[model samples]
Target chain A: MSAIERQFYHFAFDPASRVVRMALGEKKLDVTEIAVKYWAPTDELLKLNPSGLLPVLVENYEDGQTVVVCENRAILEHLEELPLSPRLWPVPMQERAEARRLVGWFERKFDYEVNALLLYEKMEKRLMGHGAPDINNLRAGRESLRDHLSYFESLLETRNWLAGRSMSYADFVCAAHLSVIDYFDEMNWQKYPHLKTWYMVIKSRPCFRPLLNDILPGVTAAAHYKELDF
Target chain B: MSAIERQFYHFAFDPASRVVRMALGEKKLDVTEIAVKYWAPTDELLKLNPSGLLPVLVENYEDGQTVVVCENRAILEHLEELPLSPRLWPVPMQERAEARRLVGWFERKFDYEVNALLLYEKMEKRLMGHGAPDINNLRAGRESLRDHLSYFESLLETRNWLAGRSMSYADFVCAAHLSVIDYFDEMNWQKYPHLKTWYMVIKSRPCFRPLLNDILPGVTAAAHYKELDF
Candidate 1:
């Protein structure tokens, strides 16, 4: 059988892709990164993902057929099953459920509020010429982000990681979304001290280097983007 | 050991809870259903779930402590692990990932477009004392629902069930949301023949009977709600 080819198709600046990229880096998987222009939705990418979303990992297993895994949470779950990575999910069923819940929370709630707001309001307008930025929507999003950050602050008060004591997929998912908003200087780090501390630990990890180096054409990282202590 | 005690706190009219209730029924687990007043936004429920979301399952898993499983998808995953129920998730990693993706798509995308729009425009105004319903948002939501229904029709074109050949958690999730909209006579069954057929099969299942019997005090089921053929 020919060697299996693993490829991930995503925009470099995408928050979802950053999470998957971090997971792949942690796994030390040699996968080719195919840059997708998310602004201009391509039929090929849409064919791979019916939702026309990003962070799709095409895994060429030994059987020659490629398995297309879309959705950041789904892709992370798929990667967790492989032996290459140190187990990112907890073994206990209850603990694993908690971890998965947080991952979904980040993807569905936080990403929808923060990343969608920042990207659509700030980035997409420049990238795609979609429309004038809606300040009201952005304000609502920022308020939602503060509410979410407060919730995370409370969670981090007791547990070391977002889900629990150990670093799991939840941390990466949260970090990925937050990093994108951080690029736009959207999050107020001081308001969420515990979240800030937890984020600092994850952000300082070796696997996070690729994400820190990510620079979009028009967007610049926050002043404290590379700082270990903000 | 005392019998495992499970309590599910949610509004009977909520689609997310309906899915969890069906899953619980399938497992033959007795859970005391506590109806949450969605309009009031009680502190007790919010304390249990900081997100203030419905369908929070508190499981007393034979151990002294109880596990709070939030998120409809996570609750379904927890139920799938219990020894009582037949497997809803496939054993293979790839199949499981596929099931998870479909569940996410339905709960997030389809629910946002179809259920949320229908509920907010038609039902929530009556419940929340919100201002006159926004016609434009409703129109956009209906258009999006048509696109979403077509996707489901296409899925049913090939497979017996939403996720695949077998009835999985995805079916319960979709059926739960659809049943809620069906309550309001929002779904035009004739428009998508394939989806209607699929819905009928799911609606007929014994686990779905409780949902059918559920009657919100002030709200009435659509004229065709009880008609199996409709």
Candidate 2:
């Protein structure tokens, strides 16, 4: 086998970054993790990812060639192409499409409606030295979260996983965002037992260990953040 | 061959919807276009797409089976799987990743920074009975559009197509947003010659015909919206 080197540029608290990290672990790729200050990115970081986005994966082969993959969606799909054991994507074509759709839902729709509000206000703004989070924004995010969590719970009531019968990237994407929300003590898990159970299954996986250990200075995680059971 | 029937529920000015339409056309799928009122979706539309988003594609086979695909990213990837004449995705694996990466860049980054601002203010707000557009949002969108257009120009200077040598979904995604911006007479195409040239190439394709013919009520297309040369 050719010598392989991998590195991930990420933010400790960003949901997208967490998703990529979990995907790397699931694929069994030994990668060096580097936290990027997206709000104040360095020149080298910008050169590596022109978009100046979080969760950029860099791979180096023995042939001295390097490839950088940006965007969480791109990174997950790229990882699936590798010869990894226990695939993150389902095998059936229709199931794959459904998984991709749910991934999109969490990445784009849920991110825009929920995470953008919650994270931007609760975490990123403070990190960037902006004023304290706006209460209205947090309220909006919490309202949207209730609806989204209910939707996920409904899906869980029927299927073994978010997409279908197998655990796929869809679960990771949801759990990643949920983890961030849990850090703020925002989720009311009692109302959604099925969704909570689904999350427990994901939390028990080895790939989720690194995410549970992440710590951002000046902001402590919730008491149960690292616990397998609440 | 089994009889195939397809329908697309879309909004006239949504960029994501436009991207799916172009993808379907490129794949030579005969689809009935239904302009959905996303702001005030009917029960039927809501039943078809629980998310109440625009650009939902429904496929019906001759045997009374049906499949509904949501999310433009999922729809584009799904269309690529069909046994169509021209391929929207590239052949090589790495190239395919690059294409998908570029597609992600436009759909998420560009949409958040540019299209969401411009289109929401210029079109959707008014259509939804909101008063006049906000000046600051429009200003922000224009500024971002300049940067995104330059980025596209930079990419075009080196490659024949956005992702690589041959046309792919990346080109269509870009053109989809550009066409919507063009409809509002917001683009300064003369400044970015390379980008303009690239747009012309994509614009001349047969798949772009239906988009050219799309006319939203009370909104007129630019003088060169449908022109082969401008």
Candidate 3:
């Protein structure tokens, strides 16, 4: 295991990349991080993952064998398979299903509904040299975000974590998406009290430390972005 | 295991639903099928999956225990966890990564690039009464599909399967997406002979039988859709 070296390629603001980074942080595994821009992906990044997606992990073994894992589900599952503590999936069949379901929910629904509108207008456009943000898209994305946040708040009203009592990857998954949104000051912290409290706790974790430290070029973080007590 | 029973809810034309159905078929798991229309989703369907996504599976145990799994990754992972033959993932680490990566590719890339354009204009608009197909969108989707097909054909030129030597779930994933596109006669089969041949071999499998028989209401399948020797 000592001979195995890891290299992770990702964009700092990419929600998908954040999930991998936070998961790796949770697993307490060290890796060499290679930052790439979403607008201008490097040739090496394309060679590794033809899809040109972020957060690709490479595991290099002593025998010259290399495994290039791409996509969130594949990379996360591959990491979970390692002999590591803190199992991501819960014990109960239903909870595990719930966690994965929520993970899919954010990836499928939230990404389309919120990120495509909100994050794209706020973050990606800035990074890509695209002109000023579209007010209509920003408004539409915010409207959709409220609905999604209310749904999560409903779940948090009963359960301690996103999935259930125990903390699962689903929480990290939710935080990764919301944190990037929150970075742009989109979240109305006063409305969702329960989610606000939950966010503060999860946001204060050691794994989340790296995320707060990350500085996105050309974009200024929100006033409370780096604060644990926010 | 005789004390256990299974039920599946799906929409016939849904690519995500077909992936689950095909995987279940390959596992030889008998499930009671419940057809639900996409436009008018039943209350029970929304209750099972809040997202109102198709292909939710429920397993009932003799002890009055029931497990509901929703979404493709969660449901498929749950099914693979069962003690079944014909593993979906290959043994080699790299092959396993490749298989999962391709699955994500179809879900994220193909769904956005092709299905949202081609399938939406062709099948969904008719089902939803959203008017006639848009020729511009169809042309754009076909152009994108050709690019994707060339990539697949390049892979098929070397490897026996989509992921690698073993006929893992990656083949089923690609088949599921392509099957839906082919249903609308969107696929230009002649351009990619290797992919066409690969599709022929997979399309002949017994697991693919139900897909062939499935008829989406108000939409006639392409003439060659059910032909095994096409």
Candidate 4:
């Protein structure tokens, strides 16, 4: 069979984009990655995904069929359906549901409470030249992050992975969100030891390596952002 | 085999809850519905779902095991997995991905741009006794809803259903969101003929019967809310 051509449209600091990126990496799929400026998305990007969301995957199969998938969860599920080895989803139905649940938790609730606030304030507005970050929003986001991180710490104390025993999409989704936040150097890993350790394990994964190298203009990641042993 | 007892915790006007409710009806599953006051979620609600979001589905299976599933997508998938008739998802993998993509689109994008704004300003604040509606937010939500409705109209013009041939979760999710907005008598259906017709078809379904009867306290639905020909 002839090789399929794949293209991934994404943004650097976007946690959702990172989720698709890590999932692709886990599947060992070689594809071209193009970064989009989310603030001023190009017409081409808008045409590709009318939603104007990041992490759009375009696949051209050998059978002359082309498919374009948007939305992070949709892309992740699509990749999981492929006959590739080292499946990112767990085996059992219940465990798989738990993995999807945690993925949804990080993608929706945590994002609404934390990531959206920080990214809009610290990242998007700056890119769009809106204004300086709002102190109130940043404060609220930071507070929520602490609470979520503490919960993650508790989860890690009992389980080897976030969803269960295996390193499923849940782990990748959480790590992707945390890594983006870590780019702002706001995470106080000292307070949450178990969560920190769990993050360290994910950070060391080969699939997560490319994300560490992502550098946005004029922004520096945390001191230990790229270090696995930190 | 003994019958499986199921309880669904939901809010009357929550779109996500409506999605699950409609899915349950389509599958012909009998489940007890419990209304949740989202503004002041009880401790038991928190324990069932720490995210404090609904609708939460608690299943008492024939095996005498109890399971609690939260998040609309998770609950819908769980119900779909059961050995029941009338599948909500399509059979082919590609079609299924498209179904999920549209479901995610309605849940995230539509929710963010339209439902979140309108509900928070008009519904949630009043329910929580927080304050009156914000004109700016309501205006923004109306504008976004128009744009989204136009898109839906275009989709319905080409396809038999939102996602594909047979009615799927996408139709239920979009219909659910629209039903919530329609509760306020805000939709201008005459402008988008195709979308209105599509909604009318869904409204006439036996699965959509329960949703039509939903009446929020002190909020009178539009005159045509429960009318099949509306």
Best by lDDT: 3
In Å, residue A27's CA in model 1 sits off its true spot by 2.3
Least accurate 10 contiguous residues by lDDT in model 3 chain A: A1-10
Give the CA lDDT, 0 to 100, for residue B116 in model 3: 90
CAPRI verdict (incorrect, acceptable, medium, high) for model 1: acceptable
lDDT of 1 at B48: 71
- Name the regions of candidate 1 deviating beyond 4 angstroms: A1-3, A92-94, A130-144, A187-193, B1-3, B92-94, B131-139
Chain B TM-score, structure 2: 0.95
**Residue range B45-158, candidate 1, lDDT tens digits:** 877766577778887866676678886867876676566656887665556666777877876578777667767887788778787778887888778877878888999999
Error of 3 at A15 (Å): 0.9
What class would a CAPRI assessor give candidate 3's docking?
A: high
Minimum summed lDDT over a 10-residue window in model 1 chain B is located at B90-99
DockQ of every predicted complex: 0.41, 0.52, 0.84, 0.52
Ranking by TM-score: 3, 4, 2, 1
Q: What's the CA RMSD for each of the models?
A: 2.9, 2.2, 1.6, 2.2
lDDT of 1 at B44: 83
> Which segments of candidate 2 are over 4 A away from where they belong?
A1-3, B1-3, B62-64, B92-94
Runs of candidate 3 exceeding 4 Å displacement:
A1-3, B1-3
